[model samples]
Target: MVNLSVATFGGGCFWCIEAVVQHLKGIEALKSGFSGGFIKNPPYREVCTGRTGHAEVIQVSFNPDIISYHDLILIFMTSHDPTTLNRQGGDKGTQYRSIILYHDDTQKEIAEQVFEEVTSLYEDPLVTELKPFEVFYNAEEDHQNYFNNNQDTPYCEIVIDPKIQKLKKMYADKLA
Candidate 1:
């Protein structure tokens, strides 16, 4: 309906990121997938090994009028640890690396500015990698909308649910 496009991000778990971004009002769709990785056509199993350069990411399509890039970037910065290089909480390795897959210079510029502002607040060098949008391979069907389907599951219970709660409490104003 809206002239929305995409913003792909990898903060650790795709499910968690998907949960948070999908709650945002402007986001039209959220596609849990793999990005910033080396393997071609990587699956969920392959990405878990930490060998693949890829990270669990969500491709977000959003309307700029409702949610500016700056706002989205802020949500992204708060949703995960940008200071952590190649990891987030218990998830470690390249598969968990923080990344922003920018489609154009505008996205890249906004991301860089946001990263700078965030990095200035924290002591560690923000390790979030800003990569050009290449290709996004959809994750397994089981992985899509995982938080909603698998909330009772251990990984979701232990990892994603809290993230969902956090997003809901912290960013309720942005919710759809």
Candidate 2:
């Protein structure tokens, strides 16, 4: 079997993050899910209420040989507004918080290092939480590939399109 590594990131909506990362080289699978939450299996509506303590997150499975974890973490950090306490754009709530749920010690160390390197890129403090990976409750099927299917929708046009554009511009060499 081909060796692969997994990384979980939450920077606002999973849809936005997934849309950008899906195009990157070595991405084996990408899933929209809720992570860093208190519940075992959180539904979208419950997680949206913010009381579930879940943040909308994307779980990325990638080939480390092609795209290092460091690069993935750095890309994620730059793409989202990590300085915000609990929001991205107008999407507010604890569920919208920026976070990196590291899968192991190596991942955690790399994420922390990348976190420091990207801090100066922002004027405000990076509030992204770096925590151990626990569980990933997959979002409902309809939310799985929101951007690709709903590109004509306003949310995709206004929010996700720009993120896709930014990813293309910033990481041209990294795209698949």
Candidate 3:
């Protein structure tokens, strides 16, 4: 069996990122969480206040044999508005900022390369932050698998549906 590697990203709401990344072929698991924060074991409500310095992040465990880290980073950059700082859609706060928490020096290097390559795609300079990985506090159980459980909800329908459709169109070959 191929060893699984982990990647953590904060690009707005964890639910949105989780919904899109979970569909990728090599992904073994996806957990919505908080990272890059000063507080320890922060709750969802606390992070929502945007004072915790945490970004809503998704910790993804995937098999690199199927999907390279470079490809995953590329997908992530395309999936979110990296040009926007501290926000995605109507979600605005430090918690909604675009960030990649790299687990190692190699991941850090790769993230930089990917960012440089994709910078020209946007008219504005990409503001996506690349930081060394730190602790990840899993989001509350109620937030797990949020899109799948709350598909009919207005938020999911209005905010996440289009992202799913876009993922399907852009990465059809990578879907599980």
Worst 10 residues of 2 by lDDT: 111-120
On residues 37-155, what C-alpha lDDT tens digit does candidate 2 reach at each position? 89989889999999999999999999999999999999999899999999999899999999999999999999889988988999999899999999999999999989999999999
Candidate 2 deviant stretches above 4 angstroms: none
Please give, for residues 50-111, the per-residue lDDT of candidate 1 as tens digits: 87788899898889999998889888988888899888899888888889999999999999
Clashing pairs in 1: 37-53, 37-54
lDDT of 1 at 145: 87
lDDT of the structure predicted as candidate 2: 0.94
Q: Is candidate 1 or candidate 2 better by lDDT?
A: 2
Worst 10 residues of 1 by lDDT: 115-124
For model 1, the stretches where C-alpha displacement exceeds 4 angstroms are none
Every model's TM-score: 0.92, 0.98, 0.98
Candidate maximizing lDDT: 3
- C-alpha lDDT score of every prediction, in listed order: 0.86, 0.94, 0.95
